[model samples]
Target: MTDDTGYEFFEHTADVGMRASGGSLAELFAHAARGLVALVAEDSAIRPAETRAVRLRAASVEALLRAWLSELLMWFDTDRFLPAEYALGAVSATALEGEVRGERFDPARHTYGTEVKGVTRHQFRVEQRDGGWTANVIFDV
Candidate 1:
């Protein structure tokens, strides 16, 4: 991440939001993942031990932002995997593919821990930027 006024993270009443600026759509999505994980744990501390596959569709960028964060949360709820790293394999006008890797949550390993209730729409936003796109998304933790 650079300091070109590229991205910023904001705290909301019940969730966290991030506004990312990049030259491409993939960069924005990847940064958003990084921002989301930053809310839960240090990005450097999270180690990838397993790989998972995910697919999603949304009518708009805002909806996609919600779907993206919710998908990450779903991995925690269903697979117990904490996503700390994201590698966006493909990105299209309306779709994306990637692998999110992280170690399974362990009581002993995770600190400052709080369960993420869900991804919410209270303060969600995603839109085009000067070069590409920027998204403001809120997630419940």
Candidate 2:
């Protein structure tokens, strides 16, 4: 379970499940975003050719994280954006904002993995334990 990457993937029947942990909630969310990118494109294949701002407000931390990741997925589904890097500007229980750096999807360069349709509400969780924060998310791939 300790890949030293701060994130890991777990088996699921239909969708994919991911767990990301860090010393802080912000880092946990950042790693979760990275986990999503790792599932889509190879880390080295994606370049920071463009930047986009992400902002979301939810009722709780778990909801906020889901919305943030779902918003990124929307870019890929709608505009073919593939984000490989993220800079978290702000992350809180009720709101989140960040800057994502990546380029338009290029099949020739980027290696696509599971195509995540959406973030699921089932089996989703966010909590703090052992001096760290953890976020468990499932994607409708």
Candidate 3:
């Protein structure tokens, strides 16, 4: 789905794809994370009442993106955590450190969306072009 935000979802064969673009790497990552959250739960229903610290390392930017999204997915899978805000302290080609602020899922108060089983590497990419960063990720439902 296309929106005013820097992120949009595309139709995949049996999955969902997300494309996010931003002026910087950190902004791009944040937009990608937001897209993932949107897929798992309604963003408007989440609250920034809790904070979770995140630190990840990978061999490349593509791998880092996968790890970042996977960590977020893990949180959702384990505790039904839905992130509302992302405060990235640092983002590099191989590492990322940040804090995600959000609350756990409460059926009475939150609206659940699709159940994202995992982040897929198929057609996954993170690239910088024309002074901007763009990321394309597909989630398996």
Candidate 4:
């Protein structure tokens, strides 16, 4: 996938890989989440008509990222939600609190993409470099 939001998808043997960078950890997380949503459905077709609250904590940044994406995937699996907008109120190395706005999937109005099964730890990483944050995540498709 290609986009101007500091995120990109890379070819993986049996899965999908995403790399996202941002000036802040919050932005990086948001970009990664967007990438995940885009993988499930055409992001342009998703609308911010509903909102959901998110609060997560982990022992480390990498774990936090995994939890964050996993939460989003859970929402999709349970409610067919596709988030289009993100409002991260607080973001730290091990905690994140935010709100995501989007609507449930509508097959007639949305183009379905890959069905992501889960976020994997293979080559997964979140780091701060050159005064910015970057994350690499792999999704089991």
Question: Could you give candidate 4's per-residue lDDT for residues 1-141 as a string of tens digits?
Answer: 236777899988889999988889999999999888888995557889999999999999999999999999999899999999999989999999989999999988998889999999999988888888889899999
Please list all clashing residue pairs in model 4, or write none if there are none: none
Q: Score candidate 1 by TM-score against the native.
A: 0.79
Clashes of each: 0, 0, 0, 0
| lDDT per residue (tens digit) for residues 30-72 in model 1 | 7776666656554336777887776777777667767787787
lDDT of 3 at 38: 79
Deviating ranges (above 4 Å) for candidate 2: 42-44
Cand. 1 Cα-lDDT: 0.68
lDDT of each: 0.68, 0.84, 0.87, 0.90
Error of 3 at 135 (Å): 0.7
lDDT of 4 at 116: 92
Extract clashing residue pairs from model 2.
Answer: none
> Residue 18 CA error for candidate 2 (Å)?
1.0
- RMSDs, each prediction? 2.9, 1.5, 1.6, 1.7
The true-versus-predicted C-alpha distance at residue 103 of model 2, in Å, is: 0.8
Candidate 3 displacement at residue 41 in angstroms = 0.6
